[model samples]
Target: MIYLDANATTAASEEVRRAVLAAMQDGFGNPSSVHIRGTNARQTITNARDEVCLLIRGALPEGVTLTSGGTEANNIVLRGIPEAIIVTTSVEHPSVLRPAEAAAEHRVVPVLVDGRADPQAIAEALPASGDVIVSVQWANSETGVIQPVEDIVTTVRSRRPDVFVHIDAAQAIGRIPVHMDGIDALTFSGHKLHAPQGTGALVLGDPEETRLKAQILGGGQEGGRRSGTQNVPGAVGLGVAFRERAKAFDEATGALRAMRDAFEAAVLSAVPGMRVNGGSSPRVPNTSNILFPGIDAMALVALLDQRDIACSVGAACSSGRPEPSHVLLAMGLSEDDAYSSVRFSFSVMNTMDEALSAADIIAETVGKMR
Candidate 1:
C-alpha cells in the first residue's frame, strides 16, 4: 500500500521495532521500583527523555513529562491551565479544541484564505485583561500549513509577559526543526515520528516555573506532573526514532518536498477544478490537501483505498464525525468545499515513484467523478 496517511501515524522504523522488542523482553521492570532491573529500566526511561528532549531543542529535560499519547499530552496542558482566557484556532486538533471549550472564554483565531494561521489575528484575539493562554498547532496536521508559532508567541508574550504559549508540535517535531525557545510548552507524539504508539511528551519551560497542576495523580511519576508507571519499552523506541530522524531531517524533507511537488503538479494537470489547499502558505515538506469542489472526500478516500492508497479527509482522530472538517471551515471554505477536501500526508518512506503513481490514481478517480 502507498501509505500517505502519515499525519495520522507512521510505521515504526526497524531500529525502533527492535528497540521495543528488546525492551519488552528485558526491560519489563517498573521504573518506580528500586530493584536492579527496575533501576536499569528507570535509566532507560531517563535516556529516552534525553533523546526525546533533543527533538524540542533547548527544552529542559526535567520539564518533559511522558504520557500515553498526544491526546493525553494535550489534555495535560489544556486542562492544567485553569480559569484562563484560552486563545486558539478553530482549526486546531480536537484534543486541544475540545478542552479549550470548557475554559473561561475560548477565543478562536480564524485561519486566513490560504488556510494558514494568521499571527496577527491571533495577536488581536488576545484579551485586553486577565491571564491569557495561547495554544496553536506548530504545523497543521491536515493541510500541513505552518503556523507562525514564534510570531504568534511573540505577539502574545510582548502583549503580556504572563501569557502562556503552548504549541501542539505533533506534526512538526522530527520532520522540522523545533526550538523550545519562547514556547512555554510543546507536545509531540511518538507514532507520528516513526516510533511506537502509546508514547508522547509534553515539554514545558520549567516544572517549578509553570506551577503546573498534576492531571493524572497517583504514584507521583513524571516529577509528580503525571502519575503512572512509565512505558519503558515505548520510551526506548521513541528515543531511538528521534535520534534516527535527527541525523537527516533536512535532507529527508528536501526529498519529500520534491516528491510532493511532482505529485501535485501531475495531479493538478490531470484533473480540473482542483485547488491546492494551503498552497499559498509555508507548509511542511511532505503534505498536500487538494480540494475537489464537486467530489465527496470520504467517498474518494474509499475509492483510493480500494487501489491501495491510504489517505484521509481530515484528522484521523475525528474521522467518523458526520460534518465537514473544522480546519477547512475555519479557512472560510463552504461546507461543500470542506467536505470536498482530502488530506494526503507523506513521510520519508514514500518515494517519488509511489507519489507519482498515487497521483495518477487520484487524477483518474477524480476525473471519472468530474
Candidate 2:
C-alpha cells in the first residue's frame, strides 16, 4: 500500500524499534524503585530526556516532561496554568481546543486564517491583571500550514511579558527546525516523527514560571508534571527517532516537498475545479489539502483505499466523525467545500514514483465519480 497519512501517525523506525526492544527486555525495572535495576531504568529515562532536549536545542533537561502524547501535554498546560487568559487559533487541533473549552474561567482569544494569530488581536484580548497563556500550533496537521510562531512569541513577550506561550509542535518537531529561543513551552508527539505511539514530551523554558499541574495523579513521574510509571521503552525509542531524524531533516523535507508539489500540479491539471487549500501560505513540506468540487471526500477516500493508496479526509483524530472539517471551516470554507477536502501527507519513505502513481489514481477516481 502507498501510505500518505504521516500527519496522522508514522510507522516507527527500525532503529527506534530496536531501542524499544532492548529497553523492554533488559531494562525492565521500575524507575521509581531504589534497586540497581531501577537505577538503570532511571538512567535510561534521563538519557532519553537529554536526547529530546537536544532535538529542540533546549538548554536544560529538567524543563522536558514526557507524556502519553500531544493531547496530554496540551491538557497539562491548559489546566495547569490557573486563571490565565488563553489565546489560540480557530484552526488548532482538538487537543488544544477541548482543554481550553473545559477551562471555563480562562478567556480564549481566537486567531484567524492567513495561518497566524495576530499579535494585535492577542494584545486586545488580554486582561489587565491576570497572567496569559497563549497556545498556538507550529504547523497545522491537515493543511501543513506553518504558523508564524516566532513572531507570535516575540509579540506576546513584548506586549505581555507575563504571558506564557505554549506551542503545539506535534507536527513540526523533527520534520522542521524548532528553535526554542522565544517559546516558553513546546509539545511534540513521538508517533508523528517515526517513533512509537503513546510517547510525547513537553519542553519548558522555565518550569517554575509555568508550573504544570499534574493531569494524571499517581506515582510521581515526569518531575510530577505528569504522574505515572515512566514508559522507559517508549521514551528511549522516541529519543532515538528524534536524534536520527535531526541528522537528515533538510534532505528528507526537500524530497517530501518535491513529491507534494508534483502531485498537486498533476491533480490540478487532471481535474477541473480542484483548489489547493492554504496554497497561498507557507506550509510544511510534506502535506497538501486539495478540494475536488462536487466529490464527497469520504467516498474519495474509500475509492483510493480500494486502490491501496491511504490518505485522509482531515485530521485522523476526527476522521471518524460525519461533520465537516473544523480546520477548513475555520478558514471560511463552505460546508460543501469542507466536505470535499482531501489531505495527502507524505513521509520520508514515499518515493517520487509512488507519489506520481497516487496522483494518477486520484485523478482517475475523481473522473469516474464526476
Candidate 3:
C-alpha cells in the first residue's frame, strides 16, 4: 500500500528494528540495579539520552526523560504544572487540550484562519501576576501548519519571562530542525520518526528551574520525574532512528518536500474545487492537508484504501468520529468544508513516483465519485 498517513505513525526502519532486538537480547537488565548487566543497561540508556538530546540542539542530556510516547510526554508538562495558569491554543491535539483544560484555571487561545496561533493572542491570555504555562504544538498533525514557537516564546516572555513555554514537537522533531533555546519543555514521539512505537522523550530546558511535579510515582526512576523500569530496547531503537535521520537530514527533507509538492500540484490540477488547507503557511515538508469541497473526506479515504492507497480524514487518534475536525473548524471552515478535508502525510520511505501515482489515482477516484 502507498502509506501516506505518516503524521499518525511511521514504520520502523530495519536498522532501528535490529537495534531494538539487540538491546532486548543483551541489555535486558534493569537500569536501577547494580549488577554488571544492569550497569551495562544503565549505560545504554545514558547513551540514548545523549543521542536524543543532540537531536534537539542545545538540550541538556540530564533533562531528557524518556516516556511511553508523545501523549505521556505532553502530559508530564501540561498536568505536571498544576500551579500555573495553562494557556494553549484551540487547535492543539487532544493530548495537550484535554489536560490543559482539566486544570483549575486555563485559557484557550484562538488561532488565525491559517491554523496558526497568534503570539499576541497567547501573550494576552496570560495573567499579570501568577505563574503561567504556555503550551503549543510546533507543527499541527492535521494541517502541518507550523506555529511560530520562537516568536510565541519571545512575546510571552516579554510579558513574563518566567512564563513556562512547552512545545509538543511530535510532528516537528526529526522532520524539521528543533532547537531548545527559550523553550522550557519539548516533547517528541519515536513512532513519528521511523522508530518503534511506545518511545518518546520530554526534554526540560532547566529541570531544576521548572521543578515539575512527577506524574507517575514509584521506584524513583527517571531521576524521580517518571517512575518505572526503563524500556531499554525502545530507547536503543529511538536513539538509532534519530542518529540515522541526523546523518541524512538535508537529503531526506529535500526529497520529502519535492514529493509533497509534486503530489499536491498533480492532484490540484486534476481535481476541481481542491485547495491545500494550510498551503500559504510554513509547514513541515512531509504533510499535505487538502480541502475537497462537496466531497466527503471519509468516503475518499475509504475509496483510496480500496485502491491500495492510504490516507486519513484527520488525526488518527480522532478517526471514525462523526463530527468535523476541531483543527479545521478552528481555522474558520464550516462543518461541510471541514468534513470534506483530508490529510496526506509522507515519510522518507515514500518516493516521487508513488506520490504521483497516488495523485493520479486520487484524481480518477474523485472524478468517479463526482
Candidate 4:
C-alpha cells in the first residue's frame, strides 16, 4: 500500500517504538506512588517533558502538560478561557473551530484564497477591551499552508500585552521550525510526529498567568492543568520521536518538498484545469491539497482506496461527512470547488518514486472521470 495520509497520522519511528517498550517493561509503576519503581517512572515522565520543552524552546519543564492528543489540548484552552473573547480563523481544524464556536463570545477571521490568515484581519478582529484570546494554527493540516504566527503574536502583544495567544501547532511542530519565544501557549500531538497515538502536550508561557482550569478534574496530575494517571510509555515514546525528528528535520523537509513539487508538476501537466490549492502560500513541505475541477473528491478517494493508495478529502475527523470543506469555504472556494478538493500529505518514509507514481495514478483517474 502507498500511504499518503501523514496529516491524519504517521507510523511511529523505530527509535520511538524502542523507547515505548523500554518504558512499559521497566517503568510500570504509577508516577504518583512513593516506591522506587514509581520514582523511576516519574523521572522518565520528567525527562520526556524536558525533551518536548527543548523542541519548542519553552521556558521551563513545569509549563508542559501532557494530554491525550491535540483535541484535548485545544479543549483545555477553549474552555479554560471562557470569559475572554476568542479571535480565531475559520480555516482551523475542527478541534480548534468547534471549541471557538462553543465559546460565548468569539470572532472567526477569514483566510485569503491562498489559505493564509492575515495578521491585519486578526488585528481588526481584536476586542475593544483587549481582553482576548487569539487562537491560530501554525500550519493548516489539510492544505499545508503556514500561518503568519510570529507577526500576529507580535502585533497582538504590542497592542495588548494582557491578551492570551494560543497556537494549535499539531501539524507544524516536527515539520517546521517552532519558536516559543512570544507564544503564550502551543499544542502538538504525538502521532503527528511519529509517536504513539493518545499522546500530546500543551506548552504554556506562564503557568501562573495563563493557568488553564483543569479540563479533566481528578487525580490532580499535570500540575493541576490536566488530571489522570500519566501515560509514561507514551510520553517517553513521544520524546524519542521528537528528538529523532529534530536531528533530521532540515534534511527530511528538503526531500519532502522536492517530492511534493515533482508530484504537483506531474499532476498539473497531465490534468488540465487542475488547480493546486494554497500553492501560492508558504506551506509545510509535506502536504498538498489539490482541486480536480470536474471530479468529486469522495469518488476519487474511493477509487484511490481501491488501488491501495490511501489519501484523504480533508481533515480525517470530517472525512465521512458528505459536506463541503469548511476550510476551503473560508478561503473563498465555492461549495462545488470545496467538495472537489483532495489532500495528499507526505511523510519521511515516502520516496520520490512513490510520489511520482501516485501523481500518475491520480492524473489517469481524473482523465477517465472527466
> Would you list the C-alpha lDDT of every candidate in the order shown?
0.87, 0.85, 0.92, 0.87
**Structural similarity to truth (TM-score) of each candidate:** 0.96, 0.95, 0.98, 0.96
Candidate 2 residue pairs in clash (backbone atoms < 3 Å): none
The window of 10 residues in a row where model 1 has the poorest summed lDDT is 314-323
lDDT tens digits, residue span 49-157, model 1: 8888777788777878888888898888888868788899888998899989988789988878776677778888888887778899989988998888778877777
Provide the clashing-pair count of each candidate structure: 0, 0, 0, 0
Query: 1-370 in candidate 2: lDDT tens per residue?
Result: 9999999999998899999999999999999999999999999998988888766865467888988899988888888876666777788899998887777555555546555567677666666667667888899998988988777777777777877788999998876788678778889899988989999988888766535567788877877778889999999998898888878878888998999999999999989889999888889899899989889999999999999999999644445567888889888888899999999999888999999999999999999998
Ranking by lDDT: 3, 4, 1, 2
Off by over 4 Å in 3: 315-320
> Which one is best on TM-score?
3
Candidate 1 regions with alpha-carbon error over 4 angstroms: 315-321
Model 1: what TM-score?
0.96
